[model samples]
Target: MEHRIATFLSRLSRTWLAAAVLAAVAIASATPAPAQDFITVASTTSTEQSGLFKHLLPEFKKATGIEARVVAVGTGQALDMGRKGDADVVFVHDKVAEEKFLAEGFGVKRLEVMYNDFIIVGPKNDPAGAKGKDVVEALKKIAGTSTPFTSRADKSGTHAAELRYWKLAGFDPPKGAWYRETGSGMGPTLNTASGMNAYALTDRGTWLSFKNRGELVILVEGDTKLFNQYGVMLVNPAKHPHVKKDSGQKFVDWVVSPAGQAAIAAYKIDGEQLFFPNAKP
Candidate 1:
């Protein structure tokens, strides 16, 4: 009888041990793994609106196993974010502003990542009667007339370029009246221009993604002043030492590397290359 009791006790102990082991296994399996570090990127709305990020970031993530959190704003705002150490990196297309940022030590070496020209989009009617003319002359015509025109005025790289073009054209557009300052991003500004049947300057990429709007044709292009170049810069780690240096460097390296350049070149929308890789220098 004692032997029988001993056997039963041993069996119960085994069952309890098995149950404990299974519970521990279940608890271990239920625990989630730590998330990978993310690189915060502040970039121009044009790049985001053009669907380039949507098409390109997945490949980057797959290649590097690092997640990218992108914040798309106007060039000016993006720069501001970088200056505040709010972003690990920035991708913007304004040459003058980019130079200023580098000189100010807000960011480190700027890498020329891509190039795309801006286009003056307006109604097919061409109400301002400016088409097929030099960009400066076209702006003069647009400003001279009271015809509705939209300006992103968000201090975007596009805005900076537009202001430079206007200054070159020798016309100072008034704040109110015919000139409308839409303190918005590229996509919204484009939609506003379409809704108001006004003229707007837009990057080729954003123009390509913009749809569900009136027929706003590319009225003026092929202007030398309209040429746009994009640059990627790492936020100066000295200013914000907490900034992830390794991840930031990796992003910069990937952007300028041959493989990354090829990826940029391969990205397309509606059979149009939104950005041409210009990583040299």
Candidate 2:
């Protein structure tokens, strides 16, 4: 009788152990899946041209396991992409347009990320004689001399700023030999200007990235009007219900975070810092 009881207890213990192993397998199979990994961002040519994303986004992906696919365009197109729900977020340099976007509820939680000054770039000969003058004065010369100048004219942030400079200079840029509008992006405008040996108003970052253009030189710089600030914002999920708010917020937060600022500060061309990180507010 004692032997039979002992045998029965041993069998029961083995049976329970097998049941526990099966239960563990079931629990493992029932565990929640890992989140999906993809996000879309619309940003400016300067950021793309400066190679900041290539330098920084891998770090973001490694940390968060979220892949960022960037669509690089002018600030106007980037904002428009966000408005049209083609992009999950926007990182751009036009403060006025960004404010308008927020006011219109197209985007939310707009945050300042970085800043850099715009400069007038032209042939080293300085045909307009714009060198060393202030931005407004330079524009006046560019207009007064009727020196060949190329304008982006793509409604980009840089284009908008150029128009502002023209206004400040007390002259509407005339349509003629002196003024040429290319309905293209910064890179293309730079190429066109270089081809024509014409002056162009451009952000510092794009100018730094423009290597093949040898004639272009920074003519007008260091003015307060040339101050260009870039901001990042998550598209309002309420407006575009498909926009991944979680991923967008993560991107915005990463860009403004200390790590992201450090990455921006570290990015350079020919040892020159392109963008100044303005992570505050």
Q: Look at candidate 2 and tell me the lDDT of residue 280.
A: 88
- Pairs with steric clashes in candidate 1: none
Number of colliding residue pairs in each model: 0, 0
Candidate 1 has what TM-score?
A: 0.88
Question: What does the lDDT read for residue 174 in candidate 2?
Answer: 54
Instruction: At residue 31, give the lDDT of candidate 1.
Output: 96
Tens-digit lDDT string for candidate 2 (1-281): 99999999999999999999999999999998886777899998778877888988998888677888899888899999999999998999899999998999999878999999999999999977999749988888888888999999888899889988998898665567689999888888999999999999999888888876868888899898889999999999999999999988898888899988988899888999988898984
- Output the worst ten-in-a-row residue range by lDDT, candidate 2: 169-178
TM, every model = 0.88, 0.85
Please name the candidate that would achieve the greatest TM-score relative to the true structure: 1
Clashing pairs in 2: none
Q: Which 10-residue window in model 1 sums to the lowest lDDT?
A: 169-178
Task: List per-prediction Cα lDDT, in the order shown.
Answer: 0.88, 0.89
Stretches of candidate 2 above 4 Å error?
1-36
Candidate 1: RMSD over Cα atoms?
Answer: 2.9
Candidate 1 residue 1 C-alpha distance from true site, Å: 20
